[model samples]
Target: MSPRRRRTEEFTSYYGRPILKEPTWEALDIAGYIFAGGLAGASSILAAGAQHTGRPRLERAAKLTAITAISASVAALVHDLGRPERFLNMLRVAKPTSPMSVGSWILSVYGPLAGASAAADVLGIFPRAGKAAGIGAGIAGSAVATYTAVLVSDTAVPTWHDAHAVMPFVFAGSAAASAGGIGAALSPLAEAGPARRMAIGGAAVETAMSFAMERSGRLSAETFHQGRAGTLLRLSKALTVGGAVGIALGGRSSRAVSAVGGLAVAAGSALLRFGIFEAGRASTLDPKYVVVPQRERLAARQEEPAKADTMG
Candidate 1:
């Protein structure tokens, strides 16, 4: 060889410019929308279970929480879109390939059911109809909880796209944590058994999944541990774990402690969403996040042919 080839120490775009455009979505609106949607979806499932178990206080609280969270979620989405009717316009057609379309449909269907169930529960009218609506809402709510993960992961954002495998599980766990949190906070200690258990289980899952995602060695995974994203994620994990512990220890003894723990869990869930959003955006801003992965792939492809030649 005339000269030994040296691997580049770092990859960069021309003039050190970013290769990918950052997402235009506002962090507050989108992150809040995600948090609320997850809270609503998971709360509906809890509501259905509470209904079946004859925990009327838990059931009614969960139902009300579901409707209110979903309403806030939809309002945030509409506000971001800058038009309320734009949401309705999406219902005109169904597109299976589009996460936005599917999510819109899910929201449309779940919203009415949640609203009807909550309204009937509060008004003490149409008990049978309300039960039916609650069941229907619970079914739709499962999709509502996890679809946002798919929606974000489907985008070109490196951090989000790379975490696609774990994102849904993360979202699902977070949703359950938030729902259980609210229920435990609002319901009496005797009726709050299920909520406390749910919060603990959800917290465990959320923590484990997030840790796995971060350690999976994806290039963009670094974004999660750097800067604002890092701060938020770390705090979220602490609060979630601490909250779960508090719920486990104090739920049976003290109402104030249980409520505080529940609030902490809910706050942690919200921060997790915001942290993930910030991580994705941060990845887009850095040229290395885009360039390095592409270079690694190109190197791998080049090595594949050489390996084949050696075998020959």
Candidate 2:
């Protein structure tokens, strides 16, 4: 065959079948679940910190938010499964290699502790027990905040797989910002100092890591700049940066400023999750993304044999 015909043939596939499996998740369900789960996890930590510091109002608000967010996260996960009963199957075995199984177990532990802590605080009963549960929930929350990153990064999606290292930090920071936003929104300005600071710090960390991921030069990075994902992520970055600035300027002295900043941060966190989900899906849909890297891998393997033969 002529060189031009060979090149053309290389680009074509039978029936134009996709080279990689598209993610079988709905944006509303999976993306929302990721945001809510992160929020719940970080809120548990905030609740524990508030309890330790004797901030009753902040503690109560954080605890309630943790429980509520986790519950909603579970609902979203189940909804994404199409059949709610399939969620139970995940609980049947604990597989270390499977991020979903591990995440399910983490959620199970976190949900009960969060619920009990919130309930005990609300009922004004067993303060010591509630504090202990809050601490446990906080530890579990860390897993929840970061595990979803592992879940996505473990997949075949080029962007997500290449982003394994930074994605966890991004998600964790976003979670902290989201939790802080919720706490700040619920507390008085004077009591919201820590939450505001957390929100700002988290936003800074999240923004830096996200920028790093986008500029890493991986083929998958194209997904972040091309379409709906790009639009949403750009908006997320603007809102996050703007909210952090707002908090830095007036969060401590003005309730209105704190509330607006908090809302912006929370909304940005949600958008980040949705944008990431969309980007991963877009990466899988393009055959070039799946083919080029694999072709390079094969070429590298072929070179290894020739190099060894030459050395011998």
Runs of candidate 2 with Cα error greater than 4 angstroms are 1-12, 304-312
Backbone clashes (count) for model 1? 0
Weakest 10 consecutive residues of candidate 2 by summed lDDT: 3-12
| lDDT per residue (tens digit) for residues 1-312 in model 1 | 211112223455688778899888898889999999999999999999999999999999999999999999999999999999998899999999999999999999999999999999999999999999999999999999999999999998999999999999999999999999999999999898898888988999999999998887887998899999999999999999999999998877888988999989989999999999999999998887766778779989999999999999
What lDDT would candidate 1 get against the real structure?
A: 0.92
TM-score, candidate number 1? 0.96
Instruction: List the candidates' TM-scores in order.
Output: 0.96, 0.93
Residue runs of model 1 more than 4 Å from their true location after superposition? 1-9
